[model samples]
Target: MCRWLAYSGTPLLLDTILYRPKHSLIDQSLHARMGVETTNGDGFGIGWYAPESGSDTPAILRDIGPAWNNRNLREIAQHVKSHLLFAHIRASTGTAVQQTNCHPFRHGRWMWMHNGSVKGFHEMRRELSLAVDPGLFLDIEGTTDSEVMFFLAMTLGLEEDPPQAVAKMVGLLERTGREHGIAAPVQMTVAVTDGTTVWAFRYASEGGARSLYYSTKVDSLRAQHPDATYLQELSEDTRLIVSEPLGDLPGAWNEVPEHSYGIVHGGHDSLHEFAPIMP
Candidate 1:
């Protein structure tokens, strides 16, 4: 398991939440209250898109160390700002702790991260990998089941239709697991983006998926609590989707429903029911 967050809407410093919040990702790295393990010290990664540079692709930074004590990460959080970003603190689920295995994996314009594990990954990896498009198969860089899920999505036409591709990928995983007699083959709360748009999902093969939440609209909260200082600092468009809330701000977060996915872009947020793509 791991802890991660995705932000879009306003260009803000990374430290604003990574380090400043009461229950920030850095805090989760040591005292995670919701993950399977309370410690996610294996590694960490960050990915963000900066439109001022005229590039649509996201830039990524990853290291195999604790996020709380990384001097380089602190420096970057203080300097770099983005309208959309991803930050993750990882807890290995049977994979080596290495930079390549750290998340926010990227392929051209797309970036992805996952927080969960495949029940019998070692037993089903070869079969699942063969299902990936031959060209994409070689792109695999790490041994984690997370990376395999990403490439599998690409092979299933991720760029053209993300939801469909992911659904297909999940369906395939379940089928493969059943074939191998492993129930509950997958459990994940994931995020993927292509600079302009973001998609987040929460699901498990046998249900009881990980925790995921999105902050309530800042403008609405500001209207209700007119004198709230934090609300005043935010733009109406700023949004955050995180594994655990950054703080205990009231009416500031809403849990994403089980078996659903959300899309955040511009000022439009949409939630849709999600189900596996049955063959």
Candidate 2:
């Protein structure tokens, strides 16, 4: 459905991943190899913690246009630096093409993006929207299953336990969808962050969700391929969880198993099986 990435590690210019890679996020917007569609030109957005501030909140920039041709994105990518960041290119799955609908949706210190969507979202939107806590519901600015999912997670306690909150959200969503007669209602490769850490998930009720991957330990990559020049410049803690591998560098990327979630921070990285819990 879409292409996105979540990066956590040493501070870096946003372009280092958004534009400078052999196949960057901008390039993927135009020629995505793994997305259901090749072009994700509906819109784009980037959210990153302020460089050197350790701020709880993040700065967000989004536009309703092809990222491949967005000069503004290029300008910011070259300047903004942060230890944690999220970038997404959207391929609308029946949602309006507008700035508010772009991914990396935010609230307070949290930022989130998704690559897959709920089946029959039109039928479930009203119920799902109503399920969100009223205070958070007022903040819902876009009409996409992804945004609803974000608010749902928030309503269920995203700030306290991201994985569990998301699990609870999925549970409620899937149950609601089934009530409305749709099976296998959720398919998602989602990433969420709160300045210092990032949580990523890949799951679907049908067991075949969209693809997701994460970079291996940078130091480990260097140890395995001492001659790989790029590995030398990156910080050892750098970790990138993306909808697809940025490149085909052997031993550099690992697929996040289907129906699983991962957490990435400075020194603690973990993976766990994901299962929905009905609310």
Candidate 3:
């Protein structure tokens, strides 16, 4: 498993969220408190949208090296700022540790990252890979199940209905996994963005999904932690969805319910039950 975070709200330097917090993503790269592994150092990646650039495509930086000690990442995080960003620390389940295999995979204006595995992927890779739309399949640059899922969702209609698209993607995996004699084949906590809104999902084929959390609303945090001046600096709509809380602030995080998904669109965020549908 791995650790990842998605942030959307007031524009701020990546350092603030990736390195400055009490238990920042960088810290989790070395010492994750909730992930299956205590350290996720195979590789890392960051993707952010620069709306000011007038391009819908996001900027992505990835390296096949531990994030905690990557000077390039440190330098970039210090200088880049964005209203929507995604950062992921990788601990490869089985795939080779390479830049292309890193998380926060990008396609057009969208970016995606996942923290869990598609069980028995090796046995079913060919079947699943062939399922991706022919046009989009040629664009797949990596060999991770995470990337495969992204393309599968895209083939299913991610641009028009992200939730439904993902549901169908997972459904395809489950149906195929069963045919391959593999039980409980899907396990994932995914975060995807289209440079404007973020959609996060937490689900597993067997019911026990990995840990996922979302920050409490800014206004609610203000009311609870009156002394935390930082709360005042952010927009009321600011939100964070992560594999774990960035800190131990009381009432600062809420676990995303099992087998469900959440959407963070400006200030109209909503959570809904998720159930896979056969593609």
- Please report the TM-score between candidate 3 and the true structure: 0.99
Question: Which candidate, 2 or 3, has the higher TM-score?
Answer: 3
lDDT per residue as tens, model 1, 1-279: 899999997788988868989999999999999899999999999999998898888999999999989999999999999889999999999989999999999998999999999999999989888988998888889999999999999988889999999999999999999999997898999999888889999999886999999989988889778888977888887889999888887898999999999999897798999999954
Q: Local error of candidate 1 at 116, Å?
A: 0.6
Candidate 3 shows a clash count of 0
Error of 3 at 145 (Å): 0.6
* Predictions in order: lDDT: 0.92, 0.90, 0.95
What C-alpha lDDT, on a 0 to 100 scale, does residue 114 get in candidate 2? 95
Q: Which candidate is the best by lDDT?
A: 3
Report each candidate's C-alpha RMSD, comma-separated, in the order given. Answer: 1.0, 1.2, 0.7
lDDT per residue (tens digit) for residues 192-263 in model 2 = 988778899999889689989999998889899999897787888889998888887889889999889998
Which lDDT tens digits does candidate 3 get at residues 9-117?
A: 9999999989999999999999999999999999999999998899999999999999999999999989989999999999999999999999899999999999899
Q: What TM-scores do the predictions have?
A: 0.98, 0.97, 0.99
Best by TM-score: 3
